[model samples]
Target: MKIRTIVFLTLFTCGSLALLVGSWLQVIPFTLTEDLGFITGALSVWLTVVENIWNFPIGIANDIFFFVLFWQAGLFADMGLQVLYVLLGLQGWYLWLHGGKNKTSLRVSNISPLELLVLVLITGIATTSLTFYLQTLQDSAPFWDALTTVLSLVAQYMLNKKFVENWYGWILADLIYIPLYIYERLYLTGVVYVTFLVMCLFGIRAWLQSRRAYA
Candidate 1:
């Protein structure tokens, strides 16, 4: 079969399956909108494998959907994180397209020591502050929410640069979030994050291969 035909078939099959599963589970109420996140995640996964810049666009869609879902669930930090994701997506698109010397675009690079240190410090502070504030606000499971919120932000920043380390952050965050989601009775989102965790492991391997090929 032609590659284009194969691609089309794969997308169609995946989308149909996601729709069927979501409907059967009643993950979305009264509409088929809930399946879009799966579709977007699939596209982003494909793009990430290809090291294509288009991942940012699909990432935007994924973030937006999750943002609304989190907001509805009263996960305010996660909800606000999506707003940041939108801005970061834009920044990443531009950086990948233009942030390099000689007017060339940037390429995947390993994390610098200084940057890594800064990220750790920032995440730590952010998590602490958010946890304290959320506890005051009577948020359910504030500590776990704050932890995942900070981890998610760091993971997202790594993704912007196509950093392999992003997957590590995702893996850790998803593991924590899965239990939190379960405790909060967000079964559907728990399932999605579990799926994301698996994908993130694959993503790390995939991006490392891409980085080697690019180098």
Candidate 2:
């Protein structure tokens, strides 16, 4: 196996173990009523740090933790999105390896004005519809949860296609997510978003560099 793949697996195992132990000890709270635990929470935060930096492998880890945290917090939209994240992760990993012209490595691409408009329109519509469902059924922070879910769909899809604008979606989502995660008492995830907020800045810069280099 590749060295990066091994490392990714190691980190994923460690992170999962940490979460399991933390949950057992009540260190990682899975539900809204539960408070955060230290070790498991920290593991999750670190996983996000890894994911933000080198996403292909780390993305697998993220989908795992995200499923647990969002489910616990009643953020069903995002929780369900985690399943999509995993599927998209595989598609993204393959594309990154062999989706360029003539099956070359993938390079970052630009988002045209029309594409941006479509993404915005879709996200807005999805967010609005989901907000109503969440408000009525889950009584959760409907708008914020729905917002994250919708934007994540756009961001994840864009990233899979190697679009530089993907980071912008993450930055926006992370800003709203910090507060929303904390409100749900998924404090570790809240911290993770803060980390994502910072790393997304770096990601945008890196991808822009790739754009020039690959162009």
**Winning model by TM-score:** 1
lDDT per residue as tens, model 2, 1-215 = 66975896688677656666677777655532222332333343344333332455556666766677667667888888888888987888788778888998777789899989998989888889989988887657878888988888898888888788888888888899889878877776676577668767867777788788877
TM-score for each of the candidates? 0.84, 0.75
lDDT of 1 by residue, 18-120 (tens): 7767687887542233456656666675676556889899889988887877776788877787898889889888877887677577766688889999999
lDDT of each: 0.78, 0.72
Model 1 gets an lDDT of 0.78
Model 2 C-alpha lDDT versus the unseen true structure: 0.72
Which ranges of candidate 1 are over 4 A from the true structure? 1-33
After aligning candidate 1 to the native by TM-score, how far in Å is the CA of 89 from where it should be? 1.0
